[model samples]
Target: MLDARREDLGRMLRAWRMARDPAALPGPVPFRGHRTYLTQLDMALLLGVSERWYRALERGEDRGYAREMIDGVARILALPPRQATALYRGTGHQPPRRPAGGVRPDAALLDLLHQQRRVSWICDQAWDVLAVNAVGARHCPWLARADANVMTWAFSAEARYQLRDWEARWAGSLLGRLRLAWQRWPDNARLDEVVRGVRREPGVAELWERTADTRETSDDAARPMYFPLVAPDPVDVRVAAYGRFGDTALRWLVLTPEDPTVAFP
Candidate 1:
């Protein structure tokens, strides 16, 4: 039975890989340097494993690949969430738990994000910027990037200028939030990758080592956050986050100007 399962998984993976158009995968389109279907070599490269290792798995000669590797393969193939979950189960590995709330935002949430007056955006538990209003994009240009992630921006060189108090206001708070997320999804490869990138920064690494037990406190009293904008003085805004009810793994963040009379452009 084990042998049969491995063979079936290998065949399925091969078919999935062959069916995808290299030009149509998500994110930035790869340069069409060569006309080819996503090959075994491509899968190997994407998963950071050798072609031989991937071939062995595909040939039903190896069924010892870790869950992370299986997941990495699923992502590279752009498998739908359900198919990915099925693949994990078919391979005799447990799939990662879905976010408590859900995966995709509902119509109402989308409408709210589109129509909100304030700078509002929705991010997943991984801090992946899913949807952002025009106001939110205008205030924080980084939110519009292909790899728009809160943790990535916080430790970037640009953060030094964009965030008024990087250490006190941003870094510590972001790290604490990430810690909470880690507690919930400890096996998340993307989250682990973000932390690894952060640790490369000396200052953030020190803070992460020191604040293992620290939990970030919410600022409900409308504490001011300064952002360098077009105005002569830095813009003062108050940020708040609301988790979506039910099984949606989404959070809405609103950034309102500190001065109620002043509206966001």
Candidate 2:
């Protein structure tokens, strides 16, 4: 089984390397003595590892590379979330966790967010806003605030007026998601701070206490929500959240209008 796992890891690494377009790498193409699809040496340079070490891993030598190194390779390869998770598991490591602080959305994710017609934004496990499309910013003005977090916004006095069915729709759901995130990353200090702060808000503590389930559930029905700054008209929108493959903690939240007649300004 161990040998099989190593073989699988090597096969995946080689396939990903071959599939990657050198021009699509996150930054400017390196001044590789020559340019084609990234070569093993180029990958080694990008990963800050000796070519021999990278080659050993790709050859299934099982040299016991550090988790950080594996994660760096995944990032450099721009592996899809699922493929990245598989890489970690094949190497017998826990998948990488979302950073507590905000993270920049990769080019692919950013492009997807921009392509969406609905209000859409991406947040880390701690609910820190990582990126927001123009529609998302227009509809959610608070997201533009410095260091904005979903927990802080949902529990704020402003949310009481903005979000309809505050207890069931926004509060309960947000708390459930937060609870899930906390359970996954109990040691994250920033997450602890956000939880503590939200618990302090009036009435929030009781609501949180009532929420026993931590798993996130889908709510398919469209619900009325008011965006006072952007749209005075009450809009029926459905909130959809998509978790990335490798980084399950990083999620894309999209608000789509149920009523096609109601348009975003």
* Tens-place lDDT digits, model 2, residues 8-33: 78978998888777765533333444
**Best candidate (score: TM-score):** 1
Alpha-carbon RMSD to native, per candidate: 8.6, 12.4
Q: lDDT tens digits, residues 1-265, model 1?
A: 3388778878987998898776543322223455557888877765667889989888877557776577667655767767777678776688766522235566777777778777788887777666677677777766755346777777888876777666766676677778778778787766776777777875777788887866556544344454444455656677778776664367888887777776766
List, in order, the clash count of every candidate structure.
5, 1
Which parts of model 2 have CA positions greater than 4 angstroms off?
A: 1-102, 214-218, 228-232
TM-score, every prediction = 0.59, 0.58
Best by lDDT: 2
lDDT of 2: 0.74
